[model samples]
Target: MDPGSKLPLSPHIQIYRLPLTALLSVVHRATGVALALGAVLLVWILALAANSAEAYGQLYPHLASWYGQIFLLGLIFSLYLHFCNGIRHLFWDIGMGFDLEIVHRTAKFAIFAAIVLTVATWAIAANLEL
Candidate 1:
């Protein structure tokens, strides 16, 4: 409380880099939110299909455009990442994989698995179209 003495200041984000687990934790929450938002897109697509062919036709062109493809890809990746991270959390809920090393390994695996699953889903869908 003395004006003459300065208290130790906590490290700012610029000064302190987050650990991998901490960064992944943040991404996990972000992806969760992204997936929730993506559900709205899903509903819109379904509603368009249910209404009429003309209504669905209106949506198809936008979805087939490059920007729309990019948005769809991001949404797909977010869905996989959120699903993978949720499984990681389920293990934690059961008091498993608590070791620091195990935690780090699983964090890496979750990200890797999500990327793999996302790519595989796209590849399979593409093949189906052919």
Candidate 2:
């Protein structure tokens, strides 16, 4: 091979079928990014809450809108997923739940827990009129 020439690269998921783990890995990172952004938003919310009622009033209406609610809901789900998966990773780091069956079961459990937590959060928020 010429020094300037690159070796042929094997085709990836775009050409071959990708596995669940591959897709889950991508989603995990994506959710992490979403959670980071959500954390920034959470800080803003806290700042607003700490400020005067007038300041919160100014921000609240925007946050109460449909678009804002949707964004918040997305953030909530992302945070839940990231949190659950983070715990799963901690368990893996401790040398537990590494078996193929256990890994699959844990992945499924994390997903279910995330959904449940997200929905429960929304329910409480609605009940509190927040």
Identify the candidate with maximal lDDT: 1
Which portions of model 2 show Cα errors greater than 4 Å? 1-11
Point out the worst 10-residue segment of candidate 2 by lDDT. Answer: 16-25
Could you tell me how far off, in angstroms, the CA of residue 17 lies in candidate 2 after the best superposition? Answer: 3.5
lDDT of 2 at 34: 81
Tens-digit lDDT string for candidate 1 (74-99)? 99998888899889999999999999
Model 2: per-residue Cα lDDT over 13-108, one tens digit each: 478776655556678999998888878888987898898788778988888999989988988898898888889899989999988988888888
Full-model lDDT for every candidate: 0.90, 0.85
Model 1: CA > 4 A from native: 1-8
Residue pairs clashing in model 2 are none
Error of 2 at 113 (Å): 0.7
